[model samples]
Target chain A: MSSYIALFGNPNTGKTSLFNNLTGSYEYVGNWSGVTVEKKVGILRQHGVPIVDLPGIYSLQPLSRDEGVATDFLLTEPCSAIVNIVDASQLRRNLHLTVQLLEFGKPLIVALNMVDVAEKRGVKVDAEKLSRCIGAPVVPVIARTGKGTKELVRAILSLSEQSGEREHVAIDYGQDVEAAVQKISEQLPDDLLASKRWLALQFLEGNERIHAYLQTYMDIAPLVAVRDEAQQALGRPLAEHIYDARDKWIVHAIETSTVIFQQKPLTLTEKIDAVVTNKYLGLPIFLTFMYIMFMLTFDWLGSPLADLLDQFFSGPLTEWLSKLLTLVGASPFIQALVLDGIVSGVGGVLVFVPQIFILFFFISLLEDSGYMARVAMVMDRFMEAIGLNGKAFIPMIIGFGCNVPGVMAARTIEQPKERLLTILLLPFMSCSARLPVYALFAGTFFAKNQAIVVFSLYVLGIVVALGLAKLFSSTLLKNESSIFVIELPPYRMPQALTLWRSTWDKGKGFVRKAGTFIFGGSVAIWLLTYVGPKGIGVSMDDSFLAVIGGVLAPILAPLGFGTWQAGASLITGFLAKEVVVSTMNIIYHAKDMDLLQGAITQHFTPLSALSFMVFVLLYIPCLATVATIRKEAGSRKWTLISIGCALTIAYTISFLIYEGGKLFGY
Target chain B: MVLTDLRQGQKAVITNLAITNEVVKQRLLHMGMHEGEKVCVKCVMPFGGPVMVEVDGQYICLRRKEAACIGVR
Candidate 1:
């Protein structure tokens, strides 16, 4: 039989690093669970031994979904040995879980992880002494460096093979609680012995799940009555007292076995946090960081790459396809269908791929570099001020990169109501794909104040998001205050490979969406316009979509973009936000424009362009985001609430901007 | 008073929890934060947002509003 080992530790304890070094896989390394809803699995190597890195959790006492998964696996799985990875720098807290695991009575090998960080901070641990006290071999390891991993593996292999009766370290819970647990355990079924202590504690805590579990498999009514009496006599929660005693015992043991001073060297994260988390300077620093990122995105990378792709696809690809159709003697109607509808519509959306990649690449860098958590911390206060939870900031930040993942990532928020609200409001954030449309307008009309105009549009997006979040929280989704507990990961120099992998994954996702939805949507939009009542073609600009858009045009007149072009763009944008840019391109013959001729200037007026950009920025999120809302909200009603609210807000804001500018004689 | 209102390093035993939501109640129970747990308030972040508390030998951070629901004596 193959030996099995389990990797366990608190969240952000570099357990994943150790797992990665041992296993050699590059899975997503998020500081926080992008969502707290799922359990993830990964394998590690140890000479024919299977090692499983359980999800990073605080203790064996399960709370969140991931925590529940970890605790359930450890308590029930047939693991030959447990590799308890303790964060060396934060020993006291890390050891809490270690101590809890110790009570499980498995063959334990302690990995004192982050020894390098601990030593730098002037905190020292006597691994030898610690080994003696816990009756487990303690090995100092820097998981991030893969140092001491071979020894850790060897220790696990030897421990797993040892078949002696395991000794459980009794945490001296107070006499009364211990008496109650002993009585309860004697009444429990034999099957509950694996986690007898945890089960005992759960019974004392009045856990209904344990009661149901016991009732299903064993006779336990007598046990429950006795546990209820014990609880009543205590006049308090037994889990709390048991936990207190357990923690005290562990703290005392750690103090006796380890040496620490009040003073420790400042960690790199500490030094960085001092400025980045500063109350006064923090927002400005964040703004400056975003400024540099966006400036580089547009001026350095996005514009050139976008121009190159636009030339390649429109100039070469389109010409080749058209020539092929001409040579093949294809019907003019079919030629127009493939060329004008499919090529023009889909090709327009695909050309902005360069800009989307540039945006997501920067976002991936921020996430990998550990700066995103700080951004969350900084944004938390303001989010809280508006009666929203801090965790909302993370998904909203992801929304700026792309709303699909942002919507998916909302699962991390423990409160369902808050999670739904965040998802519904997330689409209001100006996603990266929206940036191209904004850029096209700002480049064309407000070229003199391009950066400022782009910045203002982003601000408008945020303002609308906040207002909607507050509105939804106050009116429709007012359920309860959300549970907000987030871990801030220490700053580390992001590995290049990790950054590249994330960038590649997100870039690939963009290309995939372009091929599927964007391709299909463009063709659909083209057929609606081209295949009209008239023979192969009347003016498509006078088709059914055009007439409906014309009717809606008057509604947008106040925003200085009353044209069917802008109206039709908004209608197609419901398919995908990137379609807004493509809709503009197809409607305006953007593919035919000469790049050297200052295209933006020749195309759109300043006021109409600004209004069009703002409308795109503020309008309804795509159909996919709406579907996510329906699924997460579990109701068509709230989904309708979200749509209605978003559309109203978008129209109101755009109207204010357009009407206000005209009133001031713009 | 809420955990955030505690002076730095003050220790208190949770007497009651005002959690009305079942999800939060289940989460609190899972973290060993049932009523009567002895929780020592560690340093609060510079702002009155996420308050760090040492509960059941575990140092976990929670938002102030969440902590407010945990009654301490």
Candidate 2:
């Protein structure tokens, strides 16, 4: 049988990095909590034993959705061993979870990650002493540089090879609590993987999941009675008492096993935080960085490469394909399907690959360097003013890449009301899928100010999202503000390997979507345009698509660009935002085979194009996003509210832009 | 005094967590802000924004209102 070992740790302790080092899989590793929201499994590179990378969590008793995932897996999965990774520098807090894992009685190995970082701060850990104290093997490793990982894996394999039964440590929860736990342990089911003592402790700490799990086997009334008695005896919530006991145990273990010289003073992270989190200069500095990122995406780096790709696709590639097809005596339909349907459609979106990669590159850099948590800190006041917590900003930043994970990332927020509001407002963040539309329009019409125009659209998205957040928080989702406590992880130079991995991970999604959804969508649109009420190979103006687009055109007339082609693109855009560009490429190229940029310029002036971009910005999120909102919000009503709200906002704003432009005689 | 009242670089030990919300209390406690733990005021943002505090080698940022609920001496 293939043995399963889980890599577990508190957040920001390089758990994912170590998993990557072990499995040779490139999962994203950010220096913050809640980065891995789901459990990822990979086979170890050498031993081939499957390793699961679980989300970083504080304790087995989960407090958030991601934490719940970790705890749930531990309670249920029959893992051979648990690799409890801990940050050597923050051993005090990180080991709180470690102590709880030890209670589960699994064959456990401690990976003392970030030991170099600890040593730089004058802290030295005796790994053997720690192992002896905790009754588990401890391996010191730096996960980021892959240092000492071989020994760590060898330790895991050795531990797994041992006899299945290993000793489980039980923390003494004092006299009163221990007696109460003993009473509760007798009532636990006999078949549980975890010890009944651990279950009894979790019951006393009010872990509902444990109670619910035990409910299936036996009545939980006796368990509840024992828990309440313990709470009363302890004269406080049992969770606090249990944590206090565990904390003392951890402090004792550290004191006996580790030594600290004089502490190293805070260095670069502090000096930078002094300015980056400054009251006066913080927001401006943030805005400056955003501006530079956009300028680089649109003007400096991405656009020039995109233009060269566009030229190659529309010029040489098309000519070569057409000549080859004609020489092979291919039919006109096949020629059109290959050239117009597939090449033009998928090519339109694929040309923006450089821009998408660049945007993700910058985001990964900010995330890996630990600057994003400070951004949340600096924006807390602004967020609170709008009745949301600062941590809500993290999901919105994630939403800028895609709304599916963004909605899921809201699981980190403790409060239900705030999480829902974050989910509802995330669609307006102008995800990377919409980048091609902005690039197409800005490159065609607003060429002189391409960077600024694109930058303005992103800013507008945030402004509109904030407005809606204010509206929702005060009206439909009113609740007390959740606490804002986030760790500002020490900054480190971003690893180039990690950065490239994340950039490729996000950028590859776009290419994959183009090949699948956009490819299928373009072929369908081509067939619809080719076959009409009259016959096949008719003018597109008289085809089935024209009739469909004609019916939808008038509804969008007030928003400018009320043509059937625009209407058709908007309709297909519901599937995915990138498909909007693909739909346009097929529809426009069907008539005369014109370049997409030139075709867009002919149909839209600068003002109308700007309005269209704003429409795309605020419109309904894609189908995947809608389903995610429905699932995460766990209510069909809120899902409808999201779609309804987005449509209303998009229509109203686009109407104002178009009508206002016409009134000003633009 | 409450945590927000501490001046920059001032050290104090948390005496009581006055907040009643279970989730918020647990979050703070998990960050090593339990009673009797030592804390230092790192930075206080302008205009009554959040306060940054260092506790157990971890820097945590808390809103001013939340900071006021953390009793220290």
Candidate 3:
């Protein structure tokens, strides 16, 4: 029989890294999951057994959706054995879960992960002593280096056969609570999964799960009434007092066994965090960092690469295609459809791959370097200022790269209301995918002030996000103050392997999304224009798409953008942000240099082009983002509200930019 | 002192958690805020709102109403 072991731990404890080391596979690693807050399990093939990595969580208790999955799997399924991964440096905090698992009475192997980190921090742990205390086989392993992991697995296999009856090591609570636990245990069924003592303690503490369990399983009203009376007589809620007493006992145990010197010299991470997370300077530093990031995205790196790509695809590729068509004797309609619709549409959008890579690369570097945590800290105060919870800032920061991942990051926030609010506002943060459309217009029309134009749009995204967050928090979601307590992992020089892996992962996602959605959309746009009515062969300026664009033009005329080119991009942007640039390519016959140059000068004024860029910047996210929002929010109402609000905001901002610029005689 | 009575920036050593539930107890332990840990009040929401307290160099914010239920000394 093959054995299956599930590895579990808290966030930022190197759980994923450990799994990757053990499995030799690159699973997505983040401070939080990118989808419905559930454990993403990836199986590792061992010699004869399989290892599953569970999501990192603080406890088996279901505080969030991820935790719930971990809790459910452990209780319901009978795994051959379990490995509890612990951050050796943070053992005191990590041990709490170890104690909880002890109650389960399953065969557990302790993987003392990051032992090197603990040693570096001058914290020495006696794994032998710890194992004896917890009645488990403890292996002091440095998971990053794969040290002691094989031994740890061997220990788990050895213990798998000895699981029937183990000594129950009861935690010391005070007499009254212990007495209440004893009374409650007598009333519970023998076959119940949890410890009778624990369940009784839960009942005394007025635990919601226990109450529901009791109500459903047994006619325990009388017993609960008696327990309540006993709790009242004790002059306290039974649960609170017991937990407090247990805490004191655990502290004593740790103090007796675990030696700690708190007065250690400040580490290098602290030196950096002190300056960056400074109460006075943090906000300014955060803004400066963000400004630099936006500037670099457009000016420093993105511009040169984008220009080169544009030249290659637009200048050379288009000219070559036109010459080829002339030789092949292809009809004008077919040539236009093939060159303008397919090549210009899809190929044009793809030319901005440089900008997408730049954005995701920087984000990946920040995340790997641990600067993202500091960003979260700086933004927490500002988020609180806007009446948003601190936990909600992470998803919004993530939204700067991509709304799909941003919406998925909402799982960590815990509170349903706050999670929904974060999802609704995520699309408003300028995603990197939106950069191509901005690059096209700003590169063409606002070349003199490209950086400023790009920077202003990013600022606009923030303003719109904050506004939407405020609106949602105030009306749709009540003022629920969800607490934020995030762990600050010590900063290290980001591992080069990790950074490269992350950057490549994000870049690959961009390429994949382009290939799947943008490629298909581009081909569809090509067919539409190529096969349209009359011998005119779907002139982009007079095609069915243009007619629809014209119909929507008047409503947006005040925004100084009634052009079919701008209107058509907005329509395709609803499919995917990448498609916006491609859609413009199709309409403008961008692959044909003469047609591309002529179409831009004849059809679009600089102000209308600016309006168009602003519109794309603030417009609705791709359909995937909408579907994710609907799934995560668990209601169509919030999703619909998000879409409606995004469109309205996009229109309003474009209107201001276009009309305001024209009024100022730009 | 119970958490409800602790003022902002005041330090209190948790003598008792006062919540008897095993899950809650496990969570408090997991958070490193179990008994004997010294916690300093960081910020209290306006109008006796959710209280933010720092324990073991980490801050945890909870509603004042929930704090009132926890027994701390």
The best candidate by lDDT is 2
The residue-by-residue lDDT of candidate 1 on B1-73, one tens digit each, is: 6555687669998877787666665555545565667887754555665665656444455666677788787
Candidate 1, A566-601: lDDT as tens digits: 678788888788777656555554553244125445
Ranking by DockQ: 2, 1, 3
Give the clashing residue pairs of candidate 2, or none.
Answer: none
True contacts kept of each: 0.29, 0.71, 0.17
| TM, every model | 0.78, 0.97, 0.85
Considering every candidate listed, which one attains the maximal DockQ?
2
lDDT of 2 by residue, B1-73 (tens): 9998899889999999998777877788787788898999888877777888888778888888888988999
**Preferred candidate (lDDT higher): 1 or 3:** 1
lDDT of 3 by residue, A340-423 (tens): 667776677677788777777778766766666556655665576565766677777778788888887887776667677788
Q: TM-score: which candidate is best?
A: 2
lDDT: worst 10-residue window of model 2 chain A:
A590-599
Error of 2 at A628 (Å): 1.6
Residue A637 in candidate 1, Cα distance off native in Å: 3.1
Scoring only the A-chain of each prediction against the true A-chain gives TM-scores of 0.81, 0.96, 0.88
